[model samples]
Target: MYTTLLENIPMLFNDPTRDFVAGIIDAEGNLQILKKGSIRLVVVNTNVTILSAVRRVLADIGIEIAIRPYGKPKGNERQRYRVVIYGRGNVEKVLKVIPLQHPKFFSIPLFSSPSWGRKSGNERDPRPQLLPPPPGGGHIGGTAAV
Candidate 1:
């Protein structure tokens, strides 16, 4: 497939790849931060080509990852694969540029703006809470507050 051509090709972890990865994450992946538990950045899909590309690209940068392929999708669903990366060290590196979409929980305070917590949020405005330094002394993101 398309990914096979990349096998022998040298893929660099440059801006191009970062943008592609970010697009993929924004559309099909997520930034997961478990409350006082664990944090991980992952992308799952039924297409293996994209995931393979991700694996190879990250590998080029010396960041290792294991691609888990589901045995079966059951019923009429298509088989899928999950590209998972854990550990704060690796997650932070990816979080730097990988734009996360839904299912992403921030470690900062619930509401940066008091008005934001009103009975009804701005239905049209879908932007998440702006990231600001926590009162406990931490960076914008919840890397330490958690």
Candidate 2:
């Protein structure tokens, strides 16, 4: 079943090129909206082949990305390769292509950019909502401070 799927994966998307790029981001990727209203799309995996494929696809489509090592993962840990894309232009490129749909369908509107966000206010709010999600209100891993 896996082999058959692998063989047919390439055919899954062509016209909707964003779907293909999104597949990578969804699989081992993180699309984050930072505090400064910038987009941080991170794709990490042990498989170099797929990472390279992502690079090729994004490059051909004019969204540039840099493939980098995913940092030292402690002793005896498997190192992963990563492809990261930043900034509004790049995120805009992606959002324009596919509307940032897929991965997990959440409350973010299709017309709205999944990566678009507002910068943090310099002055501390007198009363800020404690339980509210992050600026973009999306899935974020690791420790985050409010």
Candidate 3:
């Protein structure tokens, strides 16, 4: 549905389009904490057109992003591109404009916290403390290397 719409016409920054982009993010996006403790939102797809449309929608909301080739394509596979929202401020901006309904939703507060990557001691903390697991002791998400 999104591919068809995105390929046919440009997307507006209206509420419906925002929700549509949110759905795309929820399905294809990853909210990640890089090794340096910076946060990013990434959506990967084989279709550059769709990713470009997504980028336009995000730009309308005053958030900047970059579309880059992800990696080498496997045999018989299309090259993947990533629409990335880098840095704490951009990630926060996306969260404010789009309500994400996914486990990634829990990452917003943690990513927005001022002390997210700060060291509490004299030594540089190798692994910043993340939010504790949920009440039932389930995993939240994984961190990505830089």
CA RMSD of all predictions: 11.1, 9.6, 9.2
lDDT of each: 0.57, 0.58, 0.67
Instruction: Judging by lDDT against the true structure, name the best candidate.
Output: 3
Query: Of the candidates shown, which would achieve the greatest TM-score relative to the real structure?
Result: 3
Q: lDDT score, residue 99, model 3?
A: 78
For candidate 1, report its TM-score.
0.54
Model 2 clash pairs are: none
My TM-score estimates for the predictions, one after another, are 0.54, 0.59, 0.65
Judge candidate 2 at residue 139 and give its lDDT: 40
lDDT of 2 at 58: 81
Which has the better TM-score: candidate 1, or candidate 2? Answer: 2
What's the C-alpha lDDT at position 119 in model 1? 41
Which order, best to worst by lDDT? 3, 2, 1
Task: Write one digit per residue (lDDT tens) for candidate 2, span 1-146.
Answer: 99997776666443325566677676566556555444556778877767777777788778778788877878887888888777646754654564445444334342233334334755433221222225654444331321
Cα TM-score of candidate 3: 0.65
* Stretches > 4 Å off in candidate 3: 1-16, 107-143
